[model samples]
Target: MNLFNANETKAQFILSLLPITLFFPIGIGYTGIVLFFVALLAGGQYRDKWQAIKDSPMFFPVMGLLTVTCCAGLLLERPDGFWKAFMHYQIYLVLLVFISVGAGYWQQRALRVFFAGAVLASTLLYLNAFQLLPDWSLFQNYRMYAGNKSILIGILLGIAGGWMLNQICANHGHKWLRISMWLYVAVALLFLAKTRTGSLIFVFGCALVLLRYLTFSWRSVLLVIGTVIILGVAWQTATGFRERLVGTVSDIKAFVDGGKVSADGIRLEMYRITTDIIKEHPVVGSGVGTWAIKYPERAQGLMSAEMATPHNDYLLYAAEIGAIGVCALLWIWLTQLFVAIKIGGENGMRLFTIGIAIMFGGLVNAILRDALFGIAFMILLAIPLAGISRHNYKSHFGDLDR
Candidate 1:
């Protein structure tokens, strides 16, 4: 037999529980270290995936340099403070880069596994709301949880929703099953207003994708209207669950103290502070870890301290480094995604479709919060980016199966 199997069993195994474990999820620390070694054994005994990682055109050395520059500057300004922020979180970022390189070897399957892990994590977390699972912390000490159970559920559903939608069109016989599952997911999602932005964005994106498949003849339009009316009528008559729905709305009202414009409606303030800070530290940046202390003026606008991260990733990069840094990071992320989309467009790889849908939510979520800075996102997202390089290296050898 040849060395590696047709399936990258080792890598798949590594990633299988990764979604739940990659972050500071409870039980992921030493356990991850053990699993990581197991991944090496599973990934094949001898080879390093380094060369494959270096080939990604979008892997921006400049952005890394920029981050280091900012971090270094922070150290120079105040070593005590800088060490706290950068010292703890940066390791996950580095680990992701390494794992993604391996992903390059077999890009599509690798992605499926990663997405599967993410979905599983979301599912288990949602179950916690119903007491089906325990609320053990992800990143035990590092609880940078972004969305609530319902919101996270919706986003994961959005992810699976796209896959299900693709299967509906691409496959036969399993159509009803996928549709039924999505219907349940949608109903569950409707109750998740705690994460209004995440839930709504996901639902909207899925709806847009599904709209493409609709048979929009007059009959179809009438059918759609009738369906909506029936759901509404049924919803009203079904008073059994009305209190639960009302409780959800009431909780949402309490959350939106400032008119529920989303994220406490301080994104504009974040934008203002980011712009002012950039103006002050134009060239090399105020450096990492310094923003929270140095920019208190910006954060504590009309109310108390606004937030730590600027929320928007583009802005956060700017805050960390400079315009050049932000641009470099965006360049790396977008260029790779664009190339991947093109390749998918030409070859009919469904991964391209799924990635874009997830990325849209990621992009929007990034606009509202700092998931990228979080431990789980760094490890999970970085590896995929690095994997693109392996893909490039494979391209040069005229090999299609990799």
Candidate 2:
């Protein structure tokens, strides 16, 4: 193959592989390597994508946040942490360029690639649950043990459920296959995964699908409400589900009452400590990658082990780069939600539902802290945004239209 053709083909192949990589930590690393090659092979396309990134509504806020964080990391004189923070900035830059340059090609293939990845993840997760599969050491670190696994699997299932609903509504896929995929995702999330957060998000996403596509018939509305009530009652009866529900209450009680050290109590104490530290450097903040350093001093006496930043991303950002950083991050998030809804067209509500779940889930859990989640979120977003921009450009600015 000619060098240019080889470059284009290889770049497309790597973009297709992205969705499957979301399932494994090793895959995440491999995906990055592949993306680097894709960028290098992209050549002249890089200039076009740079312009695309410039025109993207989300570009400024996201890049701005990254720049501010890097500056904070430098100001702290954290030679150790500066590189880590810089690396994150690099990840975003690479992803933005890759997505913008490849958007037109990937948009058509993204849905198929996404579903293919879901099937692979579901199969492996099922095998792992049944102990029928041998452990691959590379993916060993990605194991979804109780809480963490639930969150990750739950997020994937939620997205899958939305995809299933989209297919069913459009009547695009096989009827039986769509029904079965939704059933599997629901079963794995509720029965096998048994995560409260995941289950809630999945249900919320499904409800949006129903409300968005289904006509607002009074009978259907009542039936949906009745079904939800019955499900709520059933959820309460499940032993594991019940324990989580009750445990949340117990944790709150422990946090408030003068109870001994508990999981919830420790988290609350850590928040209190982090808050005090934020007050110390309220304006510019303690700087990125310095969480481990600042957290130890305040949380040392209160907890047995040093705590990480608060379990929350917003709080983490506020503590790291101060409220200004928080504002910038929020701007990017809100714009993403807005853009997802706008570009998503008929399925806009569905996009909003999933996007909000990811954002809210991050607030309560450490979802955004994981590099994999950040990468996955960008992939999910870039496909749609790229298509939207491309269509608009062709319609309004391209020679034929002009």
Candidate 3:
């Protein structure tokens, strides 16, 4: 019995409760995305339907890479265990993408306000993470928020940055709003810098995008962003940033050369093993779930840790399904970036999406830590996407925007 189509008024009533942002049904964000897409499809919407999803100019080519990669993985690796895990991966990532495209239907005004709320939500959580505020004991125990500081900060700043830029674009008739956005940037930087080691640098990346919108003169904006980057790089180097990045590896020369590092080490040893395995089975992989197996010893000796999968998400993809699998993963990323960059007229929603892609897309490295972060960044970023026109809803049968 499909609750969406069910004749029972009670079932429809329950369905209505699903979209409320107030009731963030934890552990079920994926379900929300899926239902939203189903609602769009079943409602019989049609205004530039295909254009909305996979929006980038080069989206089709990226999708081609994605399809080819997944095909190779499935054909080369016949492991049932890998299949089972991959099925789950597909379900969530697919829905996450759906949310991205579907967000365009949400409307320009609501997108900005909704994303502002999202930024507030992220800021509060981050403050908690720093213990400047209350820590979410639940998140600590659940460990689902993707233990990745860089990605989190990036998403927070990116969304906030986008919404702020959208305000500048919307030309809210107040010069103060633009100044307020710059202030928002400062607050965003405080949180981002404190958390991620590389994030301080990423701020320049954010500045570049902000520059584009800061002045109508694209060239001037570029110059401002470029100057900031040059200064940042010089200062970072003068202060021995390269050394600071060494982190746990700094004290341990052996690990740097041929000894051992750790998760703080980014568990590079696991990556070495995964890469080696790929060499032996380049055409396919050891199997999806099989990465959990013990890695063969390197020249030094037996591997130290018994990590099931490579810590790096992309490497995990390549290892599980080989080159083809990695292609699929990259394809999804490329497609997302393209769509986020596409302009949807003079509205806050387009600006917000572009900003998010910048902040989140720039740190593809975080995917190495948690696939969930990647998904969450893409998924939650949708709140700011412009809504479909009422015309499209009529095409979708009876789809209601509310």
Candidate 4:
């Protein structure tokens, strides 16, 4: 029997628009989230929702992380900090809601919506990069109307690139088109956006896709070699790319030689301070939201600007919630990857690509700490996982209303 009534159906429809909204301004995405929650409450079916949440493999790990953060916050007498952390981590509840109510059809629809949004956003960015767009200040300098940072845009594009790569691998319709789209995404990330983390994500995602789909062969070897040659040529010729690469190396060398904190130097300093903090509170961490409190105190006159996180997700978690929180974080990522692999379809490939992006991207940025990346990560993860779960359910029990 259909569990959804008219109100519930409307709620689902609103939920389906989330991916597209994410490509808009952040406030619009937040508004959409708020509206969806309100609609969900108006169409409540508590019993079924609870069952769905309980059945999700992600439930325990997510809850565990939440519990740890909450406890750390409360016990450490940092209610304000706890509240702040909760604000960031509350995106997980969105994922839970997705598993509870999102149907396979809606999930697929959402993925398609996301892909379309990505394409449109990419096209605009490309136009803006080339100064082809009307000289609106808002659209200038590769700035996205979505108001996301270039790095975040690159990561999102990397996710889209991964999806296209999967489609090409599966021999889906319009093979050349998919290949062209994939290349387009690569160019956007590596050239136009010029985000190092994004470029790394694209490269890493390509490796993962090829590893998953291709058997070891001479053709694969040649393909890899050719890719390397292209990258080498780009490195030599692309001014922005070469400068960023050279700048990163220079930043590290400057930091090591004279402790001069530059672009990457700030990250190194934060990592250094965070590691000390972790050593002191290795077990339970300094507690939720302690990084903002602790890092400045430790760095003192060393860092020029205030930083909330260490800019590295693993280190941030380890410093805030300790090793246990780190474990929970890893569990969340690994479990999601496992599910994506088990599903092993186009949707699975999409999820897998996102997983790679967040996991690798986390090394350079505190991915979950950022509003855009965090929200995108959870929603994208939930959509694909929900679809996979629905498929598994139908396989075992036959199709229901969903």
Candidate 5:
């Protein structure tokens, strides 16, 4: 029994490291994922693990998504593309893995590890921004070192900020420290990273947390007004924030007025063309991997540049797997939100906060299509979600078996 316990402890330690690995390069993150799964296998509780997965609220919606992907792939006769897409979608299964392996106090420990990782990564980014790090070409920018886009960095920081806000709402100790951390994240995202998507997501997430925690009172109203004022002041004063906002408006205007394709304009054009494609094949889409094959043909000479994805997850999924796939995708997100609401605590708020970030991030970027962001999304989500599941299981079954 002692030997078994030691092995289990080792396995759980491996699971704990997975979230932090996401801040590193994609290869390192992938290695962590492999080690996590290996640890799960080594733990050796197949029956209980399968039961845990089945009991989770995410099971059916996730399964529906997989089924839709398969049907779309088979119907379109692109067996190769279907297989590739199927493998990509397998990342969702990590949620079930988390639900199965994470129990008792392990969930909270993993969360701390995740937050610590985010804080460390953010510090590195700041160092890179100020050129305080060792002078190396690879360390020149946060993106180069972290192997992620500026938008992704912004989203991560925004989510971290939301998590900090949740901590404050819970009335946990270290109030001032949490507030400072949240402010740090906001400054990094808005001023340093300058990601429009991140800014919007951060504001939305903070608002959601405040609304969830605050009572219906004049104080709440004043707090909301103060937030709006701060944002307004930032808009007027921050050069990066102002330029990005102005640039997006200008790009849209250029596209509408003269059909000129700039950065945002190209995405708009892609959305338009993708929508037409979806309309043509409303049932099962062009196929799982047909976007690259079909989009260029449809959009030839229509835009200045070509992209494999439409930069919108909804449109991308709709065009690839049709309306059913799109519905399944929505089901996955909506159900996750529902579960988070049902949970209703720190864990629930964490899930809700990140869920909003992912949902809003998807509007302008194919976040899940990107390797690093997709893995980060699933793992971050699974940690809190699995915590909620563990709590529910304990309440119902009275302390899960160690």
Candidate 6:
């Protein structure tokens, strides 16, 4: 059932090289395009392989989300926005299809290169943190075409954290090397970069890995709680942490007391406005690409934040496509979670870790808005899903190599 033929060799070769641009946002996008073309060229050979997707739990949910998005876009009467969403979401769906078809081969072949790329990215981010790299500042919170550095680094750190946690739980691998690497990544994230969303992901991923595999007694649980408390205390004592905490509170209070807006306050207001928009167009939302057009109408002269989408992904989608879109979106995420469950054990833990992080990121930021994070997340996610599926297939057929 080898789908890759001599005709597909060049395509696979180009696909393998896609990981080299893991750190570069634009580079990942370009590589994704190449992967898409390669996937299309080789897809005909893998008709049977592609059929395996029908057996997957995620197949329906993913397709449902895509169908809903497309329909909403078209129904909204925004052909331009519909086209834009089609291109963006269609790429993700295509990636899922490509990965599912090549599941067995990709992890073994491409994962190492991707991890190495992540390591290099980690090193570069560290250097940038220390200002060792001129003009390469590490505080990239905003979305950019190339990618958000903070978001990218945060994801890399989460992967690194998960890898290290897997090693610890398995009680194997280069223990000291991983520890050192883990510390390095943690330092870069918690102290150097100080990306709240990324740090949250790293912590969440590590916690899940440990919880999934580790045998925790009462004493161990207490120890974990103590460690978290200490970390919380330490964060409170840090100057940057204090400022962010105070700023968040001050913004909320200001908005409540005087309609004053701070950075965070603006996001709060946006959520409120977006909710109103969604309420008005609950079924078959206002339309795709009309956030900009609709947002001003809802703002009611409250603030000057000119943006198309809300800070939250769910609200953004709901506002655009209504309840159906929301259901489809949640279905997609739920399928990811269910698939991760089907892929259980250490590998499953890793995938679930990333899945939760992506979900969490969508809550606070526009997950799909950042092309780099979205593309990279899909690639990383694909490897695990493919690996798990192949492993299951082999196990089920009693064809596992002995």
Best by TM-score: 5
TM-score each candidate: 0.64, 0.82, 0.61, 0.86, 0.88, 0.81
lDDT of 1 by residue, 1-402 (tens): 123445555554454345444423334534764666667565663435544434554445434744665555645454346656554324334444445435433434434444454445445445654656544454222122344333443454555444444445434365566556545544444442234444444445455444544585774465346436634653565353354446546545654553432434455545666778878777556666666776677565543265666546565556656676565555544554565554442122233443454445444345323333243433334333444442442231112221
Candidate that beats the other on TM-score, 1 or 6, i.e. the better one: 6
Please, what are the lDDT tens digits per residue for candidate 6 over residues 140-248?
3322213255556666666666655564555456656755665666555565445567666777877787677656576446535743764576476646645765787
Name the better of 4 and 5 by lDDT. Answer: 5
Model 1 global lDDT (CA atoms, 0 to 1) = 0.47
Top of the candidates by lDDT = 5
- lDDT per residue as tens, model 4, 97-208: 8667745455655666777777776787788777677765534435542323656666777777676666666666766676677666666666666577766776777777
Worst 10 residues of 3 by lDDT: 393-402
Error of 4 at 342 (Å): 2.4
Residue ranges of candidate 2 with Cα displaced over 4 Å: 1-9, 27-36, 39-43, 74-79, 89-91, 138-150, 170-173, 194-196, 218-238, 301-304, 344-347, 390-402
Instruction: Candidate 2: give its CA RMSD in angstroms.
Output: 5.2
Ranking 5 against 6 by TM-score, winner: 5
Report the Cα lDDT for residue 334, model 4.
Answer: 89
Clashes of each: 8, 0, 18, 0, 0, 0
Each prediction's RMSD over C-alphas, in Å, is 7.3, 5.2, 8.1, 4.5, 4.2, 4.9
Q: Model 2, range 1-402, lDDT digits (tens) per residue?
A: 111233344555556556656656645646555675755465556676667777766577668877887677667546355566546534455556555554434444555667666766666667777887576754453344644544565576667766566556545546677667766666555655546776677777777766766667774575466447645764765567567767777877776786764664466666667788788778787777666677776566665245544767777777778888778777777876776655554345545766777677766665566555566666665545553452342211111110
lDDT of 5: 0.71
- Per-residue CA lDDT of model 3 for 187-290, tens digit only, reads 44443233343234345444544544566677556545654664466446534434445664553565658865654554565666767877876656555555
lDDT of 3: 0.46
Q: lDDT of each prediction vs. the true structure?
A: 0.47, 0.61, 0.46, 0.70, 0.71, 0.63
Off by over 4 Å in 4: 1-8, 135-141, 144-148, 216-233, 253-261, 387-402
The worst-scoring run of ten residues by lDDT in candidate 2 lies at: 393-402
In candidate 2 the C-alpha lDDT for residue 27 amounts to: 56
Error of 4 at 230 (Å): 5.3
Best-first order by lDDT: 5, 4, 6, 2, 1, 3
Tens digits of per-residue lDDT for model 5, 220-325: 6765675677678767777877887787888888767865756546787887778888888887888887777778888777652368577888888888888888
